[model samples]
Target: MFTSRMFAAGAAGFALAAMGPAGTAHALHSDTFAADNAESAAVVSAQIADTGSLDGDCTGTAIAPHWVLTARHCIEPFPTPGGSVRLGQGDQQRRVQVDHWEAAPAGDIALLHTVEDMGLASYPTVSDTVPGLGAARLYGWSPDGSGKTTKLPVAEGEITELLDMSLFEGKQMINVDTHNGGKTQPGDSGGPLFVDGKVVGTLSASLGDDKDGMSDVAAYAVVAEQYDWVMETISGGGQGADAGTPGRGDLNAAWLVGGGGGVLVAIGASVVVLRGRGKSDAG
Candidate 1:
C-alpha cells in the first residue's frame, strides 16, 4: 500500500566504466551444501510466476511481508509483466504475485512490491555505509557441487575491502574472499550479506567468471547506503496504497542505525526479529 508506487520509474543511471561487466557474481561454490531450514525462511526464489510452478535464476530477501529486495538486473526488460516470489519450504510454501517494482536509480538494487503478505519473517537491516571490516557471511539457495538445489547454503569469509564498480560507481560494496576457500556460483545474485547479526548488503555481480559462472570478487549493494530508500518506501504506507497509512511514523530507523541492542517499537514497517548468529561480528 506504499502509494500506487512511491518511487520513480526507470533505474538510476550509473557509470559504464564503473560497471565494466567484469565483476558480476553468481551462485554458490561446489562445496556448499544444505543449510538449516531456519536460514531459508526469509530467503526466497525470484522466479517466473505466470506458470503455476516456480523456478528461479536469482534470489531475494523479504525485507517485509509485502516487499522484497533484489537486483534490478535479475528482472530485465524492467517492469516485468509477470513474476512471483515463492517463499518458505515444501507444501507450506507461499507464492505471492509480483505486482510492481522500483529499481535503485543508481545501483543494481531493485525493490519488488508483493500483492500479498510473503508469510515469512522479515530480516533486520543496518544504516551504516560500511559494515566494519571482519567476517561476513552470504546466504542463498544455489546449486551445490552436483548442481543440486536441495537446500540453501551459508558461505563464510573475511570481508576484505570496499569494492568499486562502473555499474554502481557511487556505491560502496562489501568484498568477500571467494578464490581461497569460499565463493559464489551462478544464480546467487541478490543474496544477503550479514554483519553483526544484521543485513548489510545484497549480493550483486562478481569479477572473473570461471566459465561456469563462478567468481572470486563479488560486489554487493551495501545495505547502509541504500537504507534510506527502503525505509521511505515502507513509510509511504506499504499496506495497500489505499490502506490510509501515514508516511513515516515509527520506522525505528534510529534504533536500527544504533545496532540491535534496544527494543524496537514497530509502527508501519515490518517488525524485524532475528536471532543473533552467536557472534558479535559477522561470522
Candidate 2:
C-alpha cells in the first residue's frame, strides 16, 4: 500500500506537470483474429470496478496465479478505488476485484493481486534477456480498429533501440518500430511486448504521435531490469506501507524527466523475469 506521504512524495516529483484523468493506448494496423493464442489468454483488461464502463482503462498480463503485471501510470494515484481487472477475451470476459497492489519502489511497474486465484493453467512468463534488434509482437485492448468490437489486437513489429537515460532517467527501456505492423495508440498502454513467446517489455510511450502519421516508435519498460523487485513483491504479497522497499518518489522524479514534463502517459512500466530474448544489458 502506498501511503499518502509516499503518494505526496511521488506527486512532488511531477509538480512541473498537472496530473489529469487517466487514458489508455491503442494499436493500429493490427489484426484482431491473430489474437487466438496462449499469450492472449494471459492478457487481462484493467478497469475501474462499478463504473459500468464497457472497455478497459488499460491492459495487463497475468504473470502468476493471482498476480498481474501492469504499468504504474495505468493505475495512477495508485490502488484506484474499486480497481479491478477483466480476464478472458471477447464474450468470455469477466471482471475481478483487486485485493491490493504493490508499486515497485523504483520503476513504473506495479503488481495487482486478485481477491481470488485466477486458476490459469498457463500464462506468458517474463524473459530474462532483452533483444537488441529483432521482431516482436504487441498485444492490447483498445477502443480502436477491431478492438472496439472484438477481442485483442495483435501487432507484429521490430525492436530498433535499447534506451538508457535517453528517455526515462536511470531507467532502462526498449524502442520498437511498429511501422510495418502498426503503431500503438491510446488504450494499448500496459500491454506486453513479446519476443519469441515470452514477455520482454511492457508498453510505456511512443516517440511520435501515431494519429498524425509521424513515426511509429513505441517505447517499453525493460522487464529484466526489475526482475528481483517484481518476484519479491508477488512472493511477499506486497510490502505494506510500513515495510518493504520505499522510494516511488525517485521513480516519479525520473518519470517526470522522462516524459519531458508533460501529461503522464497512462502506461510506462517495466516487467520482470527472463526466458528468451538473449543476454540483457539491463543491470
CA lDDT, every prediction?
Answer: 0.50, 0.54
Q: Which parts of model 2 are misplaced by more than 4 Å? A: 1-16, 19-29, 48-54, 78-81, 166-170, 179-181, 210-215, 237-283
Which candidate leads the pack in lDDT?
A: 2
Candidate 2, residue 98: how far the Cα is off, in Å: 1.2
Estimate, for each residue in 1-283, the C-alpha lDDT of model 2 and write its tens digit. 0000000112222221233232232235544344456678787766633342445555678876667887655554433445567777678778788767665665556667787667666666666566668898887664453565356767777898786622233266688877445655445566788897777887765554424432366777787777767766655535432133223322221211111011232223321111010011011
Per-prediction count of colliding residue pairs?
21, 14
Please, what is the TM-score per model? Answer: 0.68, 0.71
lDDT of 1 by residue, 156-275 (tens): 767888865323333665666643345554345666777766677777655333454345555667776666766666555333321322233343333222011111112232111111
